[model samples]
Target chain A: MMRLRLVTALLASAAAFVAVSAHADNLVTKDRVGPADAPKSFTLRLTNDGPTSTDPVWAEGYQKLFSEFIQRHPGWRIDLERMSDNIGQEQARMLEQAKSGNGPDCAAVDSFVLALFKGANVLKPLDEYFTKEEVADLFPFIREGITGPDGKIYAWWWNTDLRVLYRNKEIVPDAPKDWAELKAAALASKEKGGEGVLFNGGRWEGTTFDWLANFWAQGGKLVDDKGKPIFAEGENREKFLKAVNYFKDLVDSGAAPKRVATIVNYDEFNAAAAAGTAALFIGGNWQYGQLKNTLEPEEFAKWTFSEIPGPTADQRSTGTGGWTFGAFSNDPAKVAMCAAVVKEIYAGPGNALQQQLPTAAALYGKYDVFKTEANETFAKALVNGQARPGVPIYPEISNQIQIMMGDVLSGTKTPEAALDAANTAVQAAFARL
Target chain B: MPTTTAAAMGAAQRRVAGPSLARRIEANPFTWLVPVAVMLGVFYLYPILDVFRLGLTNASLVGSDERYTIVTLQAMFENPALLDILKTTAVFTIASVVGQQAFGLAIALLVMRGERRKLKGMVALRTLVLVAWVIPGIANGLIWQMLFSEAPFGAINSVLRMMHVSPVAWLSDPNIAMLSAVISNVWRGTAFSMIVFYAALKAIDPTLYEAASVDGAGHLQKLRFITLPQLRAAILVNSILVTIQTLNTFDAIISLTGGGPGRATEVLSLFTFNTVFRNYDLAGGSVLSVLMLVISLVLALFYASFMPRREVSE
Candidate 1:
């Protein structure tokens, strides 16, 4: 009854908004434009790469949690604003807000972007807020990723989405264990009259994530601790070349679609999978949502996911990409509250969606998705999952690498030339750093 | 009427009143354009000058830091991809602008001719062509992607299957990516030129065509002589305007190809966006923006030089 009233109030305000003005500015947000009703209100406005989903349960959870927090500290409010879903735009906004020394107490920063925030000195270290035990409970690599060189934790990751091998059980009914087997499976799936294997081969950071995951699996190093290009010299070049060559081979082979170069991001890949055209999609595990949401029951049953196979046996690897809640403030009082909010939303057993592997670390087995054998395999894969280079210059490095991946995938440049060219560019980027 | 002469009375009144506001405005036309000139200076010229200032420094989208450097400009010139990207931008701008003008004029002429003949479908056809133009860039990209994406599932592929022709990779291969982008863009952008040309064609005196027809001139000859001559102003204006628009085409290409198939269609605008926003290099992006400004200015001067000068009637 309470939830229904809130929903009704929201809908009524929305209708009023539409009636009052046909303008889009008023249409998007339910929050007030300026000033709080009370003096003690902490306007913890936030923005992210995606809008807050309207899942009532998830929202209700946050609302209840927020009300409780407000009740405990009397006369306080949280005013969150969403800027954009674009990473680069959001990063700029976050930095600008940080420079102003106000805005949301903090925001949910993507894992790859923590380095940028840290570099900009916008991130406030979380050392004083969270206890040592809480810190230890988090994934070590994640901890390492956020921790600056000065032993200060700049951010805490909320979730992770890894590149997993998804295939149709109806065609080629079995999962591939290694790189060779995965290729053979692709060939077999093609033979079965399916559209065969598909990768997120489009030009963007998505391509870089997919490419780097495979490279790590093949024992190719992207950078050292100092964020220098490792493949710029000697034997590493040949190893890195193999990764692009694999993409080239995938396209060259009849297994992958001739138009694999245009496969793009998850949505494009998901459409093919939903249409039953693409039998295999090597992409993020988050596609589970689309599979469940978009596909028919019978179709959903045929789809299953497994580890992204490595070049050698027992050499599984995947890359974890997800968003994290990070704060940027110099004030200790605001900093403390930021930590509390981050922990309350992302830490421990709280919201079901937030409890997932991508958002949080603990209580994975408790969730049905986590309990599944496939996800159990994903969890195991996470143990060896490669984290992206957490450095200020990583975005520059990734940009050049994405271009190289595009070059190799589109057959504009051979793998050797493309990879070599990317190495030189990356070397230049590192030199700047 | 009681005055020594009405002309003498009017001349005395004119001398007493000096010049009326309207007469003064008519005497110096550019005087009325002062607000517009000021607005252009503030909104347009200032930003270009600001970009130059930024290009000379290292001020970025981050914290209050005392950092200014000329190394960004040096590196931009030194970058190997600069030449190739500029070449791509040139190809894209020229092809897209020329294509937009040609298709737009043809569509406009066809529609105008049809309208003159009292054709029923002309209105609907004009409205239908604008569907591509009116749709948002992101939506247009998505719609085109669904149509041209891959084989079997894509709309084009389904048609290809019917015709027994092999599927075309619309956005994948570098050999075809720029052409694909141009085609997609031409569909969305040509309507602007069409609208302009349609209005221009409508404004032309019909008696000129009638005169040409009576002189034993064919339809093609009339078009070549009267139509072409009259439309040159629209053509020049649209060419410069569309050239800038196409050169600065970021959203459509970003949403569709993303300067991809390995930078095959990486125009300067997209490259600048990627440099600043994506790569987090503000100084470098400013230099590129300055370069884009120079390119547009050159085109502006070139187009303005050919613009017909108004005769001083006074």
Candidate 2:
């Protein structure tokens, strides 16, 4: 009789647990994120936007948004798949998955690689599913960026970020406008027991992406409209060489340490900033949120940023990178569901909390977050921002430039030799393609 | 019924039963090997054959266009970067193997001495060394990365600062990054060689040492003559195993230096990875893989030729 009673109690408890779980609209945990075991499910790939221990605000905001999304959709489920934070690896993995027909229903693809997917015919057009007003609200560049050759929006370019020089006002009061002033200020900081300037100098996309602003600031064109390698040819060669030499000079002058070669991730720069080790760093606008989260309020107030310093005061440019939600499913129902999820997370309050610049022109100034002085500065930076070449050969070109940066920074190769070698490699790869 | 003769009865019984299943299997050894043969063919031979077939094509991960071509192989051979990768692989493998073996033999001899002397911490020392080997390669790489960092809090750099020495760019220098990778690999792999050597040491006859002592031989003399000669087989085996292991090492180096400071530490395996995953050149990566396999096979054959045909005891 006692055994029977215990069994009944266990069954009642399990039933209660199931009832509570079923009542909750969605699941958002470190391991799983979605409405579990629903009749209709769509998988979404995201990175660092889910439950992360490093940033509680991002995690809570994402959870609430996903929960609300599930509540509104009733029976439909949104499965959030965590992807690699490294954009290059994520792009490669996504391309491979799409080719194999094993990809998630929707993914937050790096904006630059969307063209590659579109070329491969794995993406679905978002024109029919999205409301006309929502489509009209997108920023001009984002609209152009996501539009395929056939004149259809293939992805929702949600949020964008720009590279800039983040400086501690306490260390250096004035922002440097050019490379020479920046170097002097960096060296001065080092003399005052600070760790000097930091940037992405490692062998990865970050290294090339972070430094491409300098190249672009000089009006260097990477390729022509036909996607031919031309950055090494004509007047562009001198501009490219100057940009490469600027980084080499930084290390050669002892303004930046050689250890930058190991800093492949922007988080490394943020950590250095939060630790009060770096006086200045070249990083993305999103790092401001990270710094605000990681540092004390008083210390966070000391941080400010300016446009990326150029070869001269007159020449200024920044590289803009963003994430886009792309649909890979052929089923219209699944595509619509995925589009709804993207709209909620991107244009909704979730993006505001995430701290990246929203792509919709209508969404800006709606929140005080966009009105902040730092964000205002980022907004200006975005005005002069240049997106990477969306052609297929851009990845190969970026890779060669990445290796070139390492070689030049470490003094393994001269600026001339590195440029020649990278040009040769890019040209060879382009020829093969 | 007619009375049957014994021979007739036996013949009838044999005809009725035929050969037993076990007897049939025992009669043909090849039947027993079919499962293993199939497994080898399916798992090993098929993949290797597929790689070779892919190596002869111009396949890519992204593009749909693929065709038969030797252009990838020709380009790989003509590229100067291939020579650098080979050189780096040679240096990293040699350094790691030599370091692991040297440290391993020394630790093994010391541990044996401790045991013979009834030392209290012999077991603890062995456990500590074995702990390194048991740790995951990625963890080992991360731990070493922190230790070798040039940051103010870096363990090694902190000690250097305390000693009034400047911090060294352990992972940033083009030359030192490879050394750092080798050091981390040796630390991770030394314990493997130590265990192998320890077992070999246990199998060595104590009577020979006793005889050597009676002959007025010192420790050095005994080590030079008896111990060294007895360890010949173990050394060769360890060399072959460690060589193959170090040749294919990727995880630790990747975590430590990411084969950087301008590809200073990129070995054949890493180069192949970069070719396949980073460059998305499946055919080129396959060709590189085939080259690596050939290199490994050649080295294995070269080592096997020097191995003794029979064990000392046999």
- Provide a comma-separated list of chain B TM-scores, one per candidate: 0.86, 0.92
Instruction: Count clashing residue pairs in model 1.
Output: 6
Native A-B contact fraction in model 1: 0.68
- lDDT digits (tens) for residues B1-314 of candidate 2: 34568778987897798977798899999999999999999999999999999898887776877899888888778767789899999999999999999999999999999999999999999999999999887789889988997766678999999999988889888898889999999999999999999999999999999999999999999999998889988998999999999888887887787788777888999888777777777788899999989998999888889887876889
* Clashes per candidate (backbone, < 3 Å): 6, 0
Q: Model 1, residue A426: displacement in angstroms?
A: 2.1
What local lDDT score does residue A92 receive in model 1, on the 0 to 100 scale? 65
Pick out the ten consecutive residues of candidate 1 chain A with the lowest summed lDDT.
Answer: A26-35
For all candidates in order, state the fraction of native interface contacts they contain: 0.68, 0.51
Q: Which tens-of-lDDT digit does each residue in A46-161 have in candidate 2?
A: 77765542477778777777766677777776666777644566777788898889999888888878778887788999998777788778766777789889988898888898
Going through the candidates in order, state the TM-score of chain A alone for each one: 0.86, 0.89
Docking quality of model 1: it rates as medium
Tens-place lDDT per residue, model 1, B50-83, is 8888788765654356366777788888888999
Kindly list the per-residue Cα lDDT of model 1 for residues A376-420, writing each as its tens digit.
Answer: 666677887788887766777778777887787777787778877
lDDT of 1 at A377: 67
Candidate 2 residue spans exceeding 4 A from truth? A1-22, A25-37, A51-56, A84-87, A131-133, B1-15, B311-314
Q: What is model 2's C-alpha RMSD?
A: 5.1
